[model samples]
Target: MKVAIVHDELVRRGGAEQVVLDMHKAYPEADIFTLCYNKDKTYEEFKKARIFTSWFQYLGKSEKLIKILYFPFAILAMRMFNLKGYDVVLISTTHCGKFVRVDKNASVITYCHTPFRLAWRPFSYAIVNSSNMIIRNIFLFASRVLRVFDSMAAKASDFYLTNSKEVKARIEDSYHPEQPVSIINPAAKLDNFYISNEVKDYHLVVSRLEDYKMVDLVVKAFNQTPEKKLVIVGTGSMEAELKALAGDNITFLKAQSAAQLAKLYANCKALIFPQHEDYGITPLEAAASGRPVIAFGKGGVTETMVPYNGDSARCTSVFFEEQTVESLSAAIEKAEMLQFSPGFIRNHANLFSASNFIAKLKTFVSRIYNLKTDTDFYMSLTEKVVYARKEVA
Candidate 1:
């Protein structure tokens, strides 16, 4: 069957974009469609696929310009997709890819990373960190407009799948989808990450330098403790702002390949996940490398990481309840004291391996394709009978 994979954009590499790459692995022949494409910014593996970009790609290649226009342009660009011949259109999206149009006979299955957080939870996003009241108010108004479109897109999709319970709840609250939202947690490629013989002194942070990600919080926390070292590996819109806030204790690295990142994870004392993610992949990656995580105890991290509760042997991470410098710093101190088993940590991460993810996704697609085939058969049979009756009369 002809298949198509859709993603919101290809400008950056994050958890959502990684999901798109995994989707491609599941359906190698499926053509990839996106709002825009930037070969330099995203994963290099996408070069193997037949990629089609919307009109937005023609506008500009600037990351800031894309970020500014993404919400408004994405909705319109999604509708402009001509996926008429594809039997299945699988969307891996956090935002507007769900609005993609296809023939009535085609099945549109959305693997929603989360509801549009910017639109649905504007107060918790970049605007919350902004000092300008005028910009905040305009953003709030724009959120309302985006929400209307987001809800419409949610209702149009035939099936819904998500990466975590946290995101499923958000999707339900935001769109109130009639169908059950299946939860398929994303995976960490255990093969790509390996345990190192020597654990380094520095803590690691692997995430996009975005406002919602709260990378700045980690930088500020590390700054307060100058003795402790931090190595942040990733870049985004907030790179400059974050760097300005960081102290000499904090070092920034551009995003790395899987092999390079694995080496970083294997050597680090522990991964620092400051953001409240939908379904965090970096924590799993850290775990796969036999490294523990010191993360804010909320969102998908709570589900993925085995938090320390007077049991260092069983725990793969130390959790801090509040998203504050003090809480994270305390957690970091606690993690330093704990003696965790590398074998146990790696075993825990094995539960969310790339093989498991690929198998589950392949099964999901097969089931959906079978149901669509049955529906088409019944529809064609009904149409044939109706024509016979018309001729008889």
Candidate 2:
């Protein structure tokens, strides 16, 4: 079957980008369509795939520049892409790429990271956080206009899938699509991470330094606990401001290589996930590495993290009820007191491995296309045998 994969942009490597990579692995022949492609910023595997970019690719190759200067134009450009001959179009998007026009007969399955945050939430909570009043106002006005279009795009999809139940709830509340959204959890490379009994004194936060990520809150929480060290990995627009807010206990590191990241995950006391993510991969990665997680007690982390108080034998994390520094600091203190078994944590993480993701995704796609699998073939044989036995009786 001819398939095409569409995404918002290929400018940065994140959870959404990982989803696209997994989709490509599922359908190796599929061509990738996007508004922009920055080889330096994203995974190199994308370079192996046939990537088609819109006019926005040339206008502003940088994701930041494109969003600031020509976001509306980029949305329009996405709609203009020609995806004619493909039998199926799989869209991995948090924003406008879902609006890409495709053949009416083709099956368009949109794997939404979330309904565009700007359209569904308050201006301050939007995906693009900025201090500039002019830029913020422009996005606010644009989001108001885009809400209608975003709904139309949601309705246009043949199937809707989300990374977590949290996001599925968001979709129902925001878009109210005709069909129920399926939850397909994104996964980590389990093979790369192994349980390590030895750990460093420092805590770790592996996330983009964004407003919504609440990295600054983590920094502040660590700052208050002068004895505890916090190592932050990942860079974003908020890096400089976050660094300014950080105390001596907080150490900010730019994005690390996969090898370096694995080591960091293995060595840290626990992964500090302050943000409420759609379906957080970092927590799973940490668990897979036999490390505990200290997370905000909300969003996707609730689905993956077995809280210490709830499941002592298999617990991989402790939670903070609120997003405040006090709550987080309290959680950290609690985490210090708790003991988690590395074997148990690793076993919990194995439930969400990449192999399992691919298997489930393949089954989902087969059902959509009405394709028979080996399991289905065996079931049919069993049915035939039952019919023959009844006839003989």
Candidate 3:
């Protein structure tokens, strides 16, 4: 059967892009369709894929500029994506990629990262960081207009899958679709991470330095506690402002290579995840490195983090109920005091490995398409052979 994958844009190697990579891994033969592609910003593996881009590809490789100037065109481009010959179309999106026009007979499966965050909560969205009122207002108005199209596109899909229960709830509330949404957690490359018992004195915050990510809040929290050092690893629009806010104890590093990141994850006292992510992969990455997480006790982190109280040995994280600096500071203190088993943390992370994600995704797709996967065929053969032997006996 012919399968096609649709993604919003190949802009950067973020969590959404990682999901697309996994989707490609699950169906290597599937052709990828997107609005734009920036070879410099994305993974090299994409160069080998059968990627079809829209008319917007001529708009240049600057994703930030394209997003600001040509968002409406991007939406139009997504609607224009032709998926005629494909039997199944898997759409990976946080927005309008799911709107790709497909044949009436084709089955379309949408794996939503979240129902357009800007449309649902404009204030908390990334546009909040914009200093210019004119630009922010334009985005706000555009978001409201796009929301209608987003809901319509959602209704068109045959099946809905989301990265987390939080996003699943958002999808139901936003679209109110007739079909039920399934939860499939996005995964980390487990082989890339390593566990280490000798943790260093500093806490680590590995996230985009965005307003909604609240890396600034983590910086503020660390600023108050001079005894503890905080290492922030990521680059974003908020980098300059966040650096100004940080104290001497805080260090901001540009995005690191995979090996450097893994080493940092393995040695940090705990991974500080300050944002309410849709479905965070960083916490899982840290856990795979046998490090504990200290995260805001909301959103997708709640699903991943096994919070430590006095009694639970299985806990992989410590939670801060509020998003304020005070709450985060207290949580950090508690995290520092508590002890977590490295083996248990690594084992918990293994549950969300890339291999497991691919297996689950293949099973879900096979069921939806009413086709036998390789595993299913092998299992059937084994069963038939065993039955024949028993009958002969």
Candidate 2 lDDT by residue in tens digits, 15-126: 8898898898899988999999999889988989999999888787776786676457877888788788987789998887886877655667789998887677745565
What's the lDDT of the predicted structure labeled candidate 3?
0.82
What lDDT tens digits, residue by residue, belong to model 3 across residues 1-393?
A: 789999988978888888888889999999999988998899877998899998878875566756665557777777677778987889998876876787665667888888887777777754456548988878788778878767666666767888888889888999775567898888888898999868898999998877778898988888788878999999988999999988999988997888999999999999999888878989999999999999998988888778887844589999999999899999988887776888898999999988888888888888877733455753442343334223322
* Steric collisions counted per model: 0, 0, 0
TM-score winner: 3
TM-score for each predicted model, relative to the true structure: 0.88, 0.88, 0.89
Relative to the unseen true structure, what is the Cα RMSD of model 1?
Answer: 5.2
Clashing pairs in 3: none
Alpha-carbon shift of residue 144 in model 2 (angstroms): 1.6
- Give candidate 3's error at residue 130 in angstroms: 9.7
Candidates in order: C-alpha RMSD to true structure: 5.2, 8.4, 8.8
Tell me the whole-model lDDT of each prediction, alpha carbons only: 0.83, 0.82, 0.82
Candidate 3, residue 236: the lDDT equals 89
Q: Record all residue pairs in model 1 with backbone atoms less than 3 Å apart, i.e. clashing.
A: none
